[model samples]
Target: MKDLPADARPREKLLARGAAALSDTELLALLLRTGTAGRGVLQMAHELLAAPVDGGFGGISGLLHAGAEDLKRIKGMGGSSKRAQLVAVMELARRAIGQQLKEREVFSSPGAVKQYLQLHLAAKPHEVFAVLFLDAQNRLIAMEELFRGTLTQTSVYPREVVQRALQREAASVVLAHNHPSGTVQPSRADEALTQTLKAALALVDVRVLDHVIVAQGNALSMAEKGLI
Candidate 1:
């Protein structure tokens, strides 16, 4: 890094040409600050992004999905401080996306909705059932993880979901859950559960806008699939 020209440095290049001009490696290297052992910072960033084909979370998106504990297993990330910085950045990204949904119609940016759900649920090793409560105009009111573990129609109580929707005064909702098996395909049980909840919520004047199934780097919209 020292031998590189001033403008060639990540910090200087970012300031001069803007962040968009920097490669993914350069952007990551900026956060890393320095190389480790025999690896240069740029080289390390590249390796982390590339990872390995089998069981490795390859690329930038996958790296973030790897989370803090997974990152600890990687070389050059022995320092807790470095891991903290990455986790902090990921949290900021979540909040920033959440704020956008709060301020605008959640459906206006469907991709953001998927991304928000992914950041929150995609990394989980177990099943998680969550709901996004929405106002009259479809902006986010609040999101809650209402249930966990096996998400059967019986296990995920409709009574609890209806209560929360009422508590939030939500007019509509988006249901979501993560598949830790890395398969985003909604099961027959998933379809049955969505229908069960939709009917239960309908009694209270709440609409189930969508039910999304998420896994690492994948998502499925029940609404889009005509399963809702």
Candidate 2:
């Protein structure tokens, strides 16, 4: 890094150009700070973002879905403090998005909802059924993981979803879940469950805004796909 011209450095380039101008590796290098004896920080960053075959998370989004053990597999992430820092930063990202939803209408930024759900659920080893309760203005009231099941499927009860919505006094809700199998495509059973929940909620004057399916680095909005 020192041999590289001052202006060419990540910190310098970021200062001159802006964070968005930096590549994924450059952004990561800024966080990583330094590398081991033989490897440089930039090289370490490159390795960290490399494909699974190369012992990396594959990309920034993939890293977001990585857990403590996953971080342990990386070369420079062995230290407890570094792992803790990465975990804390990821949690902050989730909280920041949650705050944004709380302040504005949820659908006003549909992508945010997908990102929020991914941050919360995509890393799981098993399936999870969760819901976002929203007020009349469509702002998020609360999000809850109501059920958990096997890798392939989850046994969700409409009655429980309805009860939670009532407890939150929500006017509308968004259903979401993760496919640990890395598929964002909604199954027939997923569609059936959405319809079942929609009808049950409608009985109590609650609206089903959308159902989002999340996987590593991808998300599908059922409403966007005309499924909801």
On lDDT, the candidate that comes out on top is: 1
- Cα-based lDDT for every prediction: 0.89, 0.88
Model 2: how far residue 108 lies from native, Å:
1.4
Candidate 2 pairs with clashing backbones? none
Per-residue accuracy of model 1 over 69-174 as CA lDDT, tens digit each = 8877768787898888887887788899999999999999999999999888887778999999999999999999999998899899999999999999999999
lDDT of 2 by residue, 1-228 (tens): 777899889999999999998999998888878887888889988887898788988787778777777798888789887677677777788899999999999988998999999988886778988999999999999999998885222478888889999999999999999998999999988998899899999999999989999988889999999998
**Location of the lowest summed lDDT over 10 successive residues in candidate 2:** 149-158
Over 4 Å off, model 1: 2-23, 50-58, 65-70
